[model samples]
Target: MFWQWLTAPWQYEFMVRAILLSVVVGLVCGALSCYMVLRGWALMGDAISHAVLPGVILAHVLNLPLALGAFVFGVGSVLTIGFVESQTRIKEDTVIGIVFTGFFALGLVLLSKVKSTIDLTHILFGNVLGISNTDIYQTVISSVVTLTILFLRQRDFLLFCFDPTHARSIGINTNLFHYLLLSLLSLTAVAGLQAVGIILVVAMLITPGATAYLLTDRFDRMLGLAMGLGAAAAIVGNYVSFYLDVATGGCIVLVQTLLFGLAVFFAPKHGILARKFWAKIDL
Candidate 1:
Protein backbone atom coordinates (compact mmCIF):
# COMPACT_ATOMS: atom_id res chain seq x y z
CA MET A 1 0.00 0.00 0.00
CA PHE A 2 2.86 2.39 0.77
CA TRP A 3 4.85 1.54 -2.31
CA GLN A 4 3.02 4.22 -4.31
CA TRP A 5 5.22 6.93 -2.78
CA LEU A 6 8.26 5.44 -4.54
CA THR A 7 6.68 5.44 -7.98
CA ALA A 8 4.47 8.55 -7.91
CA PRO A 9 5.59 11.54 -9.92
CA TRP A 10 4.66 13.81 -7.06
CA GLN A 11 7.16 11.98 -4.87
CA TYR A 12 10.12 13.66 -6.47
CA GLU A 13 13.21 15.20 -4.87
CA PHE A 14 11.24 17.81 -2.93
CA MET A 15 8.87 15.26 -1.45
CA VAL A 16 11.75 13.15 -0.23
CA ARG A 17 13.35 16.23 1.24
CA ALA A 18 10.21 17.12 3.17
CA ILE A 19 9.90 13.65 4.64
CA LEU A 20 13.55 13.57 5.66
CA LEU A 21 13.43 17.06 7.06
CA SER A 22 10.39 16.21 9.13
CA VAL A 23 12.10 13.16 10.58
CA VAL A 24 15.16 15.10 11.67
CA VAL A 25 13.19 18.05 12.95
CA GLY A 26 10.77 15.80 14.79
CA LEU A 27 13.54 13.85 16.44
CA VAL A 28 15.47 16.86 17.67
CA CYS A 29 12.47 18.92 18.65
CA GLY A 30 10.90 16.01 20.49
CA ALA A 31 14.06 15.44 22.50
CA LEU A 32 14.38 19.01 23.70
CA SER A 33 10.66 19.44 24.01
CA CYS A 34 10.56 16.91 26.82
CA TYR A 35 12.92 19.10 28.77
CA MET A 36 10.88 22.21 28.09
CA VAL A 37 7.65 20.56 29.18
CA LEU A 38 9.21 19.10 32.31
CA ARG A 39 10.75 22.43 33.23
CA GLY A 40 7.44 24.25 32.77
CA TRP A 41 8.76 26.17 29.81
CA ALA A 42 6.01 25.10 27.46
CA LEU A 43 4.54 28.62 27.41
CA MET A 44 8.01 29.91 26.86
CA GLY A 45 8.13 27.79 23.72
CA ASP A 46 4.86 29.34 22.58
CA ALA A 47 6.19 32.80 23.27
CA ILE A 48 9.36 32.15 21.35
CA SER A 49 7.43 30.79 18.38
CA HIS A 50 5.20 33.86 18.13
CA ALA A 51 8.02 36.26 18.88
CA VAL A 52 9.95 35.13 15.80
CA LEU A 53 7.20 36.15 13.41
CA PRO A 54 8.48 39.67 13.01
CA GLY A 55 11.92 38.39 12.16
CA VAL A 56 10.53 36.25 9.38
CA ILE A 57 8.40 39.03 7.93
CA LEU A 58 11.29 41.51 7.98
CA ALA A 59 13.55 38.93 6.36
CA HIS A 60 11.00 38.39 3.61
CA VAL A 61 10.67 42.15 3.21
CA LEU A 62 14.43 42.84 3.15
CA ASN A 63 15.10 39.81 0.95
CA LEU A 64 17.61 38.52 3.49
CA PRO A 65 18.16 35.01 4.84
CA LEU A 66 14.99 34.20 6.73
CA ALA A 67 16.66 31.69 9.03
CA LEU A 68 19.27 34.20 10.14
CA GLY A 69 16.69 36.83 10.84
CA ALA A 70 14.47 34.39 12.67
CA PHE A 71 17.35 33.12 14.79
CA VAL A 72 18.30 36.62 15.79
CA PHE A 73 14.75 37.39 16.81
CA GLY A 74 14.42 34.16 18.71
CA VAL A 75 17.54 34.94 20.68
CA GLY A 76 16.34 38.48 21.10
CA SER A 77 13.05 37.23 22.56
CA VAL A 78 14.82 35.13 25.16
CA LEU A 79 17.05 38.06 26.01
CA THR A 80 14.09 40.32 26.23
CA ILE A 81 12.50 37.96 28.71
CA GLY A 82 15.57 37.92 30.90
CA PHE A 83 15.81 41.67 30.77
CA VAL A 84 12.17 42.20 31.61
CA GLU A 85 12.20 39.76 34.46
CA SER A 86 15.19 41.49 36.02
CA GLN A 87 14.12 45.06 35.39
CA THR A 88 10.38 45.12 35.75
CA ARG A 89 7.86 44.38 38.49
CA ILE A 90 5.55 42.53 36.12
CA LYS A 91 5.03 38.78 36.26
CA GLU A 92 6.34 36.39 33.61
CA ASP A 93 3.02 35.75 31.92
CA THR A 94 2.51 39.49 31.59
CA VAL A 95 5.91 39.88 30.03
CA ILE A 96 5.31 37.05 27.59
CA GLY A 97 1.96 38.58 26.71
CA ILE A 98 3.41 42.00 25.94
CA VAL A 99 6.46 40.77 24.07
CA PHE A 100 4.81 38.18 21.84
CA THR A 101 1.91 40.47 20.90
CA GLY A 102 4.28 43.30 20.03
CA PHE A 103 6.51 41.06 17.96
CA PHE A 104 3.60 39.45 16.14
CA ALA A 105 2.11 42.88 15.52
CA LEU A 106 5.36 44.00 13.95
CA GLY A 107 5.28 40.93 11.74
CA LEU A 108 1.76 41.74 10.62
CA VAL A 109 2.87 45.21 9.57
CA LEU A 110 5.85 43.87 7.64
CA LEU A 111 3.72 41.24 5.91
CA SER A 112 1.28 43.91 4.85
CA LYS A 113 4.13 45.93 3.42
CA VAL A 114 4.93 42.99 1.19
CA LYS A 115 1.30 42.87 0.12
CA SER A 116 2.12 42.22 -3.50
CA THR A 117 2.10 38.48 -2.96
CA ILE A 118 -1.30 36.85 -2.56
CA ASP A 119 0.24 33.52 -1.55
CA LEU A 120 1.39 34.61 1.88
CA THR A 121 -0.57 31.96 3.70
CA HIS A 122 2.54 29.84 3.87
CA ILE A 123 4.21 32.36 6.16
CA LEU A 124 1.54 31.98 8.81
CA PHE A 125 0.70 28.28 8.50
CA GLY A 126 3.56 26.62 6.57
CA ASN A 127 3.57 24.46 3.42
CA VAL A 128 5.24 21.18 4.25
CA LEU A 129 3.63 19.53 1.26
CA GLY A 130 5.48 22.00 -0.95
CA ILE A 131 8.92 22.15 0.64
CA SER A 132 11.82 23.48 -1.47
CA ASN A 133 15.47 22.48 -1.92
CA THR A 134 16.66 25.42 0.20
CA ASP A 135 14.24 24.46 2.97
CA ILE A 136 15.67 20.95 3.18
CA TYR A 137 19.19 22.27 3.74
CA GLN A 138 17.97 24.73 6.35
CA THR A 139 16.13 22.07 8.30
CA VAL A 140 19.08 19.67 8.21
CA ILE A 141 21.56 22.29 9.36
CA SER A 142 19.37 23.37 12.27
CA SER A 143 18.70 19.80 13.33
CA VAL A 144 22.39 18.90 13.27
CA VAL A 145 23.35 21.95 15.27
CA THR A 146 20.73 21.15 17.89
CA LEU A 147 21.79 17.53 18.15
CA THR A 148 25.48 18.37 18.38
CA ILE A 149 25.01 20.84 21.18
CA LEU A 150 22.62 18.56 22.99
CA PHE A 151 24.95 15.58 22.71
CA LEU A 152 28.05 17.47 23.75
CA ARG A 153 26.49 18.62 26.99
CA GLN A 154 24.00 15.88 27.59
CA ARG A 155 24.88 15.38 31.26
CA ASP A 156 25.06 19.06 32.00
CA PHE A 157 21.81 19.58 30.20
CA LEU A 158 20.14 16.87 32.21
CA LEU A 159 21.29 18.36 35.48
CA PHE A 160 20.37 21.87 34.44
CA CYS A 161 16.96 20.70 33.36
CA PHE A 162 16.13 18.53 36.35
CA ASP A 163 17.38 21.02 38.92
CA PRO A 164 19.12 24.27 38.17
CA THR A 165 20.09 24.88 41.79
CA HIS A 166 21.79 21.53 41.93
CA ALA A 167 23.40 22.10 38.56
CA ARG A 168 24.82 25.37 39.82
CA SER A 169 26.01 23.75 43.00
CA ILE A 170 28.11 21.44 40.84
CA GLY A 171 29.87 24.42 39.13
CA ILE A 172 27.79 24.14 35.98
CA ASN A 173 27.10 27.53 34.44
CA THR A 174 23.37 27.37 34.79
CA ASN A 175 22.62 30.70 33.13
CA LEU A 176 24.78 29.81 30.19
CA PHE A 177 23.02 26.51 29.82
CA HIS A 178 19.63 28.19 30.08
CA TYR A 179 20.34 30.77 27.38
CA LEU A 180 22.04 28.17 25.24
CA LEU A 181 18.99 25.96 25.52
CA LEU A 182 16.87 28.93 24.51
CA SER A 183 19.05 29.41 21.47
CA LEU A 184 18.52 25.79 20.50
CA LEU A 185 14.79 26.19 20.98
CA SER A 186 14.84 29.29 18.80
CA LEU A 187 16.69 27.51 16.02
CA THR A 188 14.37 24.53 16.14
CA ALA A 189 11.32 26.78 16.09
CA VAL A 190 12.67 28.79 13.17
CA ALA A 191 13.51 25.69 11.15
CA GLY A 192 10.14 24.10 11.83
CA LEU A 193 8.38 27.31 10.89
CA GLN A 194 8.98 26.74 7.18
CA ALA A 195 7.22 23.39 7.36
CA VAL A 196 4.80 23.88 10.27
CA GLY A 197 4.38 27.61 10.94
CA ILE A 198 4.60 29.44 14.30
CA ILE A 199 1.64 28.20 16.37
CA LEU A 200 1.95 24.62 15.27
CA VAL A 201 5.57 24.77 16.37
CA VAL A 202 4.26 25.09 19.93
CA ALA A 203 2.24 21.94 19.47
CA MET A 204 5.26 20.17 18.03
CA LEU A 205 7.43 21.26 20.94
CA ILE A 206 4.96 20.33 23.65
CA THR A 207 2.66 17.51 22.60
CA PRO A 208 5.15 14.83 21.66
CA GLY A 209 7.02 15.30 24.92
CA ALA A 210 3.77 15.05 26.83
CA THR A 211 2.72 11.91 25.04
CA ALA A 212 6.11 10.36 25.63
CA TYR A 213 5.96 11.17 29.32
CA LEU A 214 2.93 8.93 29.56
CA LEU A 215 4.60 6.04 27.78
CA THR A 216 7.99 5.94 29.52
CA ASP A 217 9.33 5.91 33.09
CA ARG A 218 12.83 7.24 32.58
CA PHE A 219 13.74 10.69 31.23
CA ASP A 220 15.96 9.37 28.45
CA ARG A 221 13.43 6.76 27.51
CA MET A 222 10.73 9.44 27.43
CA LEU A 223 12.80 11.46 25.00
CA GLY A 224 13.26 8.45 22.77
CA LEU A 225 9.57 7.66 22.81
CA ALA A 226 8.73 11.27 22.09
CA MET A 227 11.02 11.34 19.08
CA GLY A 228 9.61 8.08 17.78
CA LEU A 229 6.04 9.29 18.25
CA GLY A 230 6.89 12.55 16.52
CA ALA A 231 8.33 10.70 13.53
CA ALA A 232 5.28 8.53 13.25
CA ALA A 233 3.02 11.58 13.39
CA ALA A 234 5.00 13.40 10.74
CA ILE A 235 5.13 10.46 8.33
CA VAL A 236 1.52 9.47 8.81
CA GLY A 237 0.42 13.06 8.57
CA ASN A 238 2.30 13.52 5.33
CA TYR A 239 0.67 10.44 3.86
CA VAL A 240 -2.76 11.57 4.98
CA SER A 241 -2.24 15.03 3.53
CA PHE A 242 -1.00 13.63 0.23
CA TYR A 243 -4.10 11.49 -0.24
CA LEU A 244 -6.65 14.02 1.07
CA ASP A 245 -4.94 17.10 -0.39
CA VAL A 246 -5.16 18.75 3.02
CA ALA A 247 -2.95 20.90 5.19
CA THR A 248 0.25 19.10 6.17
CA GLY A 249 1.11 20.88 9.43
CA GLY A 250 -2.42 20.63 10.73
CA CYS A 251 -2.61 16.95 10.04
CA ILE A 252 0.66 16.29 11.82
CA VAL A 253 -0.38 18.33 14.84
CA LEU A 254 -3.72 16.50 14.97
CA VAL A 255 -1.83 13.25 14.95
CA GLN A 256 0.18 14.44 17.93
CA THR A 257 -2.99 15.40 19.72
CA LEU A 258 -4.46 11.97 19.11
CA LEU A 259 -1.33 10.28 20.40
CA PHE A 260 -1.44 12.36 23.54
CA GLY A 261 -5.12 11.57 24.06
CA LEU A 262 -4.45 7.88 23.71
CA ALA A 263 -1.69 8.11 26.28
CA VAL A 264 -3.89 10.01 28.69
CA PHE A 265 -6.66 7.44 28.50
CA PHE A 266 -4.68 4.24 28.38
CA ALA A 267 -1.25 4.54 29.94
CA PRO A 268 -0.49 1.65 32.29
CA LYS A 269 0.25 3.27 35.62
CA HIS A 270 -0.99 6.80 35.30
CA GLY A 271 -3.76 6.91 32.70
CA ILE A 272 -7.27 7.98 33.64
CA LEU A 273 -9.15 5.04 32.20
CA ALA A 274 -6.53 2.57 33.32
CA ARG A 275 -6.56 3.90 36.88
CA LYS A 276 -10.32 3.76 37.00
CA PHE A 277 -10.37 0.20 35.74
CA TRP A 278 -7.79 -0.82 38.38
CA ALA A 279 -9.77 0.93 41.11
CA LYS A 280 -12.86 -1.03 40.12
CA ILE A 281 -10.89 -4.27 40.38
CA ASP A 282 -9.63 -3.29 43.83
CA LEU A 283 -13.23 -2.63 44.96
Candidate 2:
Protein backbone atom coordinates (compact mmCIF):
# COMPACT_ATOMS: atom_id res chain seq x y z
CA MET A 1 0.00 0.00 0.00
CA PHE A 2 2.84 2.39 0.81
CA TRP A 3 4.54 1.58 -2.46
CA GLN A 4 1.31 2.07 -4.38
CA TRP A 5 0.75 5.39 -2.70
CA LEU A 6 4.27 6.48 -3.65
CA THR A 7 3.64 5.59 -7.25
CA ALA A 8 0.20 7.18 -7.47
CA PRO A 9 1.08 10.64 -8.74
CA TRP A 10 3.05 9.22 -11.61
CA GLN A 11 0.23 7.04 -12.89
CA TYR A 12 -1.62 9.93 -14.47
CA GLU A 13 -0.73 12.30 -17.29
CA PHE A 14 -2.04 15.29 -15.37
CA MET A 15 0.26 14.41 -12.54
CA VAL A 16 3.17 14.26 -14.92
CA ARG A 17 2.34 17.70 -16.25
CA ALA A 18 1.85 19.07 -12.77
CA ILE A 19 5.22 17.72 -11.68
CA LEU A 20 6.90 19.27 -14.72
CA LEU A 21 5.23 22.62 -14.14
CA SER A 22 6.09 22.55 -10.46
CA VAL A 23 9.79 21.92 -11.19
CA VAL A 24 9.93 24.71 -13.74
CA VAL A 25 8.20 27.21 -11.49
CA GLY A 26 10.17 26.09 -8.49
CA LEU A 27 13.55 26.44 -10.20
CA VAL A 28 12.84 29.89 -11.55
CA CYS A 29 11.32 31.21 -8.34
CA GLY A 30 13.97 29.62 -6.19
CA ALA A 31 16.86 31.02 -8.21
CA LEU A 32 15.41 34.51 -8.33
CA SER A 33 14.54 34.38 -4.66
CA CYS A 34 18.17 34.54 -3.53
CA TYR A 35 18.44 37.97 -5.09
CA MET A 36 15.12 39.04 -3.65
CA VAL A 37 16.15 38.01 -0.15
CA LEU A 38 19.55 39.67 -0.39
CA ARG A 39 18.06 42.89 -1.73
CA GLY A 40 15.27 42.90 0.87
CA TRP A 41 12.67 42.70 -1.90
CA ALA A 42 10.34 40.15 -0.32
CA LEU A 43 7.58 42.74 -0.17
CA MET A 44 8.28 43.69 -3.73
CA GLY A 45 7.66 40.09 -4.77
CA ASP A 46 4.35 40.20 -2.93
CA ALA A 47 3.48 43.47 -4.63
CA ILE A 48 4.01 42.15 -8.13
CA SER A 49 2.15 38.93 -7.41
CA HIS A 50 -0.92 40.79 -6.20
CA ALA A 51 -0.63 43.58 -8.75
CA VAL A 52 -0.97 41.12 -11.62
CA LEU A 53 -4.59 40.48 -10.72
CA PRO A 54 -6.02 43.46 -12.57
CA GLY A 55 -4.18 42.52 -15.72
CA VAL A 56 -5.53 39.00 -15.41
CA ILE A 57 -9.09 40.24 -15.25
CA LEU A 58 -8.51 42.63 -18.13
CA ALA A 59 -7.09 39.83 -20.18
CA HIS A 60 -10.14 37.71 -19.52
CA VAL A 61 -12.36 40.56 -20.65
CA LEU A 62 -10.50 41.17 -23.86
CA ASN A 63 -10.03 37.46 -24.60
CA LEU A 64 -6.29 37.93 -24.60
CA PRO A 65 -3.53 35.76 -23.27
CA LEU A 66 -3.52 35.94 -19.48
CA ALA A 67 0.27 36.03 -19.38
CA LEU A 68 0.37 39.20 -21.46
CA GLY A 69 -2.03 41.08 -19.26
CA ALA A 70 -0.35 39.84 -16.11
CA PHE A 71 3.13 40.82 -17.30
CA VAL A 72 1.97 44.34 -18.19
CA PHE A 73 0.36 44.97 -14.83
CA GLY A 74 3.26 43.43 -12.94
CA VAL A 75 5.71 45.76 -14.69
CA GLY A 76 3.26 48.63 -14.33
CA SER A 77 3.08 48.13 -10.57
CA VAL A 78 6.88 48.23 -10.21
CA LEU A 79 7.13 51.36 -12.31
CA THR A 80 4.36 53.02 -10.37
CA ILE A 81 6.07 52.23 -7.12
CA GLY A 82 9.36 53.56 -8.43
CA PHE A 83 7.78 56.77 -9.65
CA VAL A 84 5.95 57.30 -6.41
CA GLU A 85 9.08 56.74 -4.36
CA SER A 86 11.07 59.17 -6.48
CA GLN A 87 8.45 61.93 -6.47
CA THR A 88 7.46 61.87 -2.82
CA ARG A 89 8.91 61.68 0.65
CA ILE A 90 7.16 58.39 1.28
CA LYS A 91 9.23 55.29 1.87
CA GLU A 92 9.49 52.47 -0.68
CA ASP A 93 7.47 50.07 1.47
CA THR A 94 4.61 52.52 1.80
CA VAL A 95 4.62 53.18 -1.91
CA ILE A 96 4.61 49.47 -2.64
CA GLY A 97 1.71 48.84 -0.29
CA ILE A 98 -0.35 51.63 -1.75
CA VAL A 99 0.22 50.74 -5.39
CA PHE A 100 -0.24 47.00 -4.95
CA THR A 101 -3.38 47.31 -2.84
CA GLY A 102 -4.88 49.86 -5.20
CA PHE A 103 -4.14 47.62 -8.17
CA PHE A 104 -5.54 44.57 -6.36
CA ALA A 105 -8.72 46.41 -5.45
CA LEU A 106 -9.11 47.54 -9.02
CA GLY A 107 -8.81 43.95 -10.12
CA LEU A 108 -11.47 42.90 -7.67
CA VAL A 109 -13.79 45.66 -8.84
CA LEU A 110 -13.28 44.70 -12.46
CA LEU A 111 -13.88 41.08 -11.62
CA SER A 112 -17.15 41.98 -9.95
CA LYS A 113 -18.40 44.03 -12.87
CA VAL A 114 -17.84 41.25 -15.35
CA LYS A 115 -20.08 38.22 -15.67
CA SER A 116 -19.36 35.11 -13.63
CA THR A 117 -17.48 33.19 -16.27
CA ILE A 118 -14.20 33.53 -14.50
CA ASP A 119 -13.32 31.16 -11.69
CA LEU A 120 -12.25 33.42 -8.88
CA THR A 121 -11.03 30.54 -6.78
CA HIS A 122 -8.83 29.18 -9.52
CA ILE A 123 -7.46 32.59 -10.32
CA LEU A 124 -6.69 33.37 -6.72
CA PHE A 125 -5.56 29.95 -5.54
CA GLY A 126 -4.61 28.16 -8.77
CA ASN A 127 -5.51 24.71 -10.15
CA VAL A 128 -2.29 23.08 -11.20
CA LEU A 129 -4.01 19.84 -12.10
CA GLY A 130 -6.04 21.69 -14.70
CA ILE A 131 -3.07 22.97 -16.62
CA SER A 132 -3.32 22.83 -20.39
CA ASN A 133 -0.73 22.30 -23.08
CA THR A 134 -0.61 26.00 -23.84
CA ASP A 135 0.08 26.89 -20.22
CA ILE A 136 2.92 24.38 -20.18
CA TYR A 137 4.46 25.92 -23.29
CA GLN A 138 4.17 29.46 -21.98
CA THR A 139 5.62 28.45 -18.64
CA VAL A 140 8.50 26.68 -20.31
CA ILE A 141 9.26 29.68 -22.49
CA SER A 142 9.01 32.14 -19.65
CA SER A 143 11.16 30.00 -17.38
CA VAL A 144 13.80 29.62 -20.05
CA VAL A 145 13.89 33.32 -20.84
CA THR A 146 13.93 34.41 -17.22
CA LEU A 147 16.57 31.91 -16.13
CA THR A 148 18.79 32.59 -19.13
CA ILE A 149 18.76 36.33 -18.50
CA LEU A 150 19.44 35.83 -14.80
CA PHE A 151 22.35 33.45 -15.38
CA LEU A 152 23.93 35.64 -18.06
CA ARG A 153 23.64 38.81 -16.01
CA GLN A 154 24.20 37.35 -12.58
CA ARG A 155 27.23 39.54 -11.85
CA ASP A 156 25.54 42.77 -12.83
CA PHE A 157 22.41 41.89 -10.90
CA LEU A 158 24.41 40.97 -7.82
CA LEU A 159 26.28 44.27 -7.98
CA PHE A 160 23.10 46.20 -8.51
CA CYS A 161 21.39 44.60 -5.57
CA PHE A 162 24.31 44.92 -3.14
CA ASP A 163 25.49 48.37 -4.13
CA PRO A 164 23.80 50.27 -6.89
CA THR A 165 25.99 53.31 -6.42
CA HIS A 166 29.14 51.25 -6.90
CA ALA A 167 27.64 49.61 -9.93
CA ARG A 168 26.95 53.02 -11.37
CA SER A 169 30.48 54.13 -10.46
CA ILE A 170 31.83 51.23 -12.47
CA GLY A 171 29.84 52.41 -15.53
CA ILE A 172 27.26 49.64 -15.37
CA ASN A 173 23.78 50.84 -16.31
CA THR A 174 22.16 50.40 -12.92
CA ASN A 175 18.88 51.77 -14.14
CA LEU A 176 18.68 49.21 -16.89
CA PHE A 177 19.32 46.34 -14.50
CA HIS A 178 16.85 47.81 -12.06
CA TYR A 179 14.04 47.72 -14.58
CA LEU A 180 15.26 44.45 -16.00
CA LEU A 181 15.03 42.79 -12.62
CA LEU A 182 11.53 44.10 -12.19
CA SER A 183 10.59 42.77 -15.62
CA LEU A 184 12.01 39.39 -14.75
CA LEU A 185 10.17 39.40 -11.44
CA SER A 186 6.95 39.98 -13.33
CA LEU A 187 7.76 37.24 -15.79
CA THR A 188 8.53 34.75 -13.03
CA ALA A 189 5.33 35.68 -11.20
CA VAL A 190 3.30 35.02 -14.34
CA ALA A 191 5.00 31.67 -14.86
CA GLY A 192 4.20 30.77 -11.27
CA LEU A 193 0.53 31.71 -11.62
CA GLN A 194 -0.49 28.50 -13.35
CA ALA A 195 1.02 26.46 -10.52
CA VAL A 196 0.24 28.39 -7.37
CA GLY A 197 -1.74 31.45 -8.49
CA ILE A 198 -1.08 35.00 -7.31
CA ILE A 199 -1.56 34.43 -3.60
CA LEU A 200 0.94 31.63 -3.05
CA VAL A 201 3.38 32.71 -5.73
CA VAL A 202 5.05 35.16 -3.36
CA ALA A 203 5.84 32.35 -0.95
CA MET A 204 7.51 30.40 -3.71
CA LEU A 205 9.53 33.50 -4.56
CA ILE A 206 10.67 34.23 -0.99
CA THR A 207 10.74 31.08 1.10
CA PRO A 208 13.26 28.96 -0.76
CA GLY A 209 15.69 31.82 -0.94
CA ALA A 210 15.22 32.71 2.70
CA THR A 211 15.67 29.11 3.71
CA ALA A 212 18.81 28.86 1.60
CA TYR A 213 20.08 32.06 3.12
CA LEU A 214 19.80 30.47 6.53
CA LEU A 215 21.71 27.43 5.32
CA THR A 216 24.62 29.06 3.51
CA ASP A 217 26.80 32.16 3.52
CA ARG A 218 27.80 32.13 -0.13
CA PHE A 219 25.51 33.50 -2.82
CA ASP A 220 26.25 30.74 -5.34
CA ARG A 221 25.60 28.05 -2.78
CA MET A 222 22.46 29.88 -1.74
CA LEU A 223 21.17 29.74 -5.29
CA GLY A 224 21.88 26.05 -5.65
CA LEU A 225 20.41 25.18 -2.28
CA ALA A 226 17.31 27.22 -2.90
CA MET A 227 16.66 25.53 -6.24
CA GLY A 228 17.17 22.09 -4.73
CA LEU A 229 14.84 22.86 -1.87
CA GLY A 230 12.20 24.23 -4.19
CA ALA A 231 12.31 21.25 -6.49
CA ALA A 232 12.14 18.87 -3.56
CA ALA A 233 9.27 20.76 -1.99
CA ALA A 234 7.31 20.70 -5.21
CA ILE A 235 7.80 16.99 -5.72
CA VAL A 236 7.00 16.00 -2.17
CA GLY A 237 4.10 18.43 -1.94
CA ASN A 238 2.54 17.13 -5.12
CA TYR A 239 2.87 13.52 -4.07
CA VAL A 240 1.46 14.22 -0.65
CA SER A 241 -1.36 16.25 -2.05
CA PHE A 242 -2.33 13.45 -4.39
CA TYR A 243 -2.91 11.08 -1.51
CA LEU A 244 -4.30 13.63 0.91
CA ASP A 245 -6.64 15.23 -1.60
CA VAL A 246 -5.55 18.71 -0.64
CA ALA A 247 -4.89 21.75 -2.78
CA THR A 248 -1.64 21.03 -4.60
CA GLY A 249 -0.33 24.59 -4.56
CA GLY A 250 -1.09 25.05 -0.89
CA CYS A 251 0.61 21.79 -0.11
CA ILE A 252 3.71 22.90 -1.98
CA VAL A 253 3.80 26.17 -0.08
CA LEU A 254 3.25 24.35 3.18
CA VAL A 255 6.15 22.02 2.47
CA GLN A 256 8.40 24.94 1.69
CA THR A 257 7.32 26.61 4.89
CA LEU A 258 8.03 23.48 6.86
CA LEU A 259 11.48 23.22 5.35
CA PHE A 260 12.14 26.84 6.22
CA GLY A 261 11.16 26.22 9.82
CA LEU A 262 13.50 23.26 9.99
CA ALA A 263 16.31 25.31 8.55
CA VAL A 264 15.71 28.10 11.04
CA PHE A 265 16.12 25.86 14.04
CA PHE A 266 18.61 23.26 12.80
CA ALA A 267 20.95 24.76 10.23
CA PRO A 268 24.50 23.90 11.28
CA LYS A 269 26.09 27.35 11.23
CA HIS A 270 23.31 29.94 11.24
CA GLY A 271 20.33 28.31 12.88
CA ILE A 272 18.84 29.64 16.09
CA LEU A 273 20.14 26.69 18.07
CA ALA A 274 23.60 27.05 16.59
CA ARG A 275 23.85 30.71 17.57
CA LYS A 276 22.73 29.93 21.09
CA PHE A 277 25.20 27.10 21.35
CA TRP A 278 28.06 29.34 20.27
CA ALA A 279 26.93 31.98 22.73
CA LYS A 280 27.01 29.45 25.57
CA ILE A 281 30.47 28.30 24.54
CA ASP A 282 31.78 31.88 24.57
CA LEU A 283 30.46 32.33 28.09
lDDT of 2 by residue, 1-283 (tens): 9898778788999999998899989999999999999999999999999999999889878987777888899999998998999999999999999999999999988988884877778878887899878778888998999999999999999999999999999899998998888888888888887788889999999999999999999889999999999889999989888988899999999999999999999999999999999999999
Number of the top-ranking candidate, with lDDT as the measure: 2
Q: Report, for every candidate in turn, its global Cα lDDT versus the true structure.
A: 0.82, 0.91
lDDT of 1: 0.82
TM-score of 2: 0.96
Give the poorly placed runs of model 2, Cα more than 4 Å off.
Answer: none
Candidate 2 residue 158 C-alpha distance from true site, Å: 1.0
Candidate 1 lDDT, 1-283, residue by residue in tens: 5577545624567666667777777888888888888888998999988888888777766766667778889889878887998898999988988888888788787778777852467867887767767667777888898988987898888888889999888788999998888889888887778767777998889999999888778988887898898888888777677678788888888888999999999998779988999999999
Query: Which residue pairs in candidate 1 have backbone atoms (N, alpha carbon, C) closer than 3 angstroms, thus clashing?
Result: none
Residue 152 displacement (Å), model 2:
0.8
